[model samples]
Target: MSNHKDEVEFPKMSFLLMAVTTGFVGGILWSLIGYLCYYFNYSTIEPNILLEPFTVGTWRESWIGIILTIILYGIISIGVALVYYILLKKLNTMWVGIGYGFVLFLVVFLILNPIFPSMKPFLQNDINTLIAAACVYILYGLFIGYSISYEHNEIKYFKEKELKR
Candidate 1:
């Protein structure tokens, strides 16, 4: 029997592009969920919370600020995707995604947010907002994790099909 690595076979460019596009989609989904929660008063958390430093009086004055926040979050999401991709070889992607989302919640909410004085009040809110934010992150995590799994399978199948030809 030959030992072959269950490899993630794809061009680096394809992987990078996929990660970025997935991140973009995740960001859009996150923003939509955030706004919905805001509308319902389920949570006061906003997508632009970390962007407080970059904006002046309001986010409306500078569209660039909004765009920048999205882009930044997208980049961060790539890190989440990377973790999923790395662990996909060994474990279930869905569970890994959940763990990834939880870790992200801990890192951002518990660790990073407290570092910024501007974010203090937002983080200090009651438990309901935390639950809402956790839900949002878990959903985003599931998207990235499943997406990577699906994309990887597509690429692998194409390669196998080509070999058969």
Candidate 2:
């Protein structure tokens, strides 16, 4: 007979919290990197330009624009993390994350290009800009995907190991 307490199920919050935190970190960090790359002339994509569609038509070079973009990315990433948790949490592989990042990059650069007036279409972007932005997205995806996957798998692994002992 199994212990009643052990058999009983409870709502888990840590994973959800981790997903939120990781998503926020990934968004904030990656967006900052992207913005910096743009600032340094390493990438053509920039946050203020991307967000111009949402804001009044004015070029904001102040710290406020940068902070707003970073925060907005973090918030968006929280939703993205939830999506990953719901759909892709079971796949504990690094490639999945990398692909996820690449997909996001494509979505923004190609599919979402028309939505933002400031964003150049995929064809208009040179190879270097694409590479730099793609790399940032890839790393962000890795940060979010691998983190959630590892946490999920690590929990299951330890449980299985304990059961076998």
Candidate 3:
């Protein structure tokens, strides 16, 4: 006989909220990594520039662009998190998260950049920029993956506590 307790039923609304929280947290990590790369001259690109391409020329010149970029970056991060939550929820581990990040790097730097005109410039960037971008994406993935798994565990823990009460 299986000795496992019944799986806890996670609430959909809370799950969604948790996903958003994780996404934003991941986005912040990504942004911090970008700044570090920029500081080291490894890359001059930033989330503000990528998320708000319309403001590319004046992105670093104003606060409005920075705000818009942060907001848009958060939304993009949330979208990525949603994809993980919906499609890859069953595969959650630190190493798996690292792999996920690498895969995301390939998708953006190799496939999408080559196919999409808007993304072509990203491809044309210097080698250091490319590397930096890959690292940043990987970091974001790591954060997202870890966050999802941790949040799920927390939910399970709470559910078990309730049952014991």
By TM-score, the best candidate is 2
lDDT of 3 by residue, 24-114 (tens): 8777667767767877888756545554434446545477666666666777888889888877666658876777888988877676654
What would you estimate as the lDDT of candidate 1? Answer: 0.71
Best by lDDT: 2
RMSD of each: 7.0, 4.9, 6.6
Report the lDDT tens digits of candidate 2 across residue range 52-127: 7777744455788778888989999999888888889989999999999889889888788888886778988888
- Candidate 2 residue pairs that clash: none
Model 3 worst lDDT window (10 residues): 47-56
* lDDT tens per residue, model 1, 6-32: 656664558657866787778767866
**Which residue pairs in model 3 clash with each other?**
none
* Global lDDT scores for all candidate models: 0.71, 0.85, 0.73
How high is each candidate's TM-score? 0.73, 0.86, 0.72
Instruction: Candidate 3: give its CA RMSD in angstroms.
Output: 6.6
If both were scored by TM-score, which would come out higher, candidate 1 or candidate 2? 2
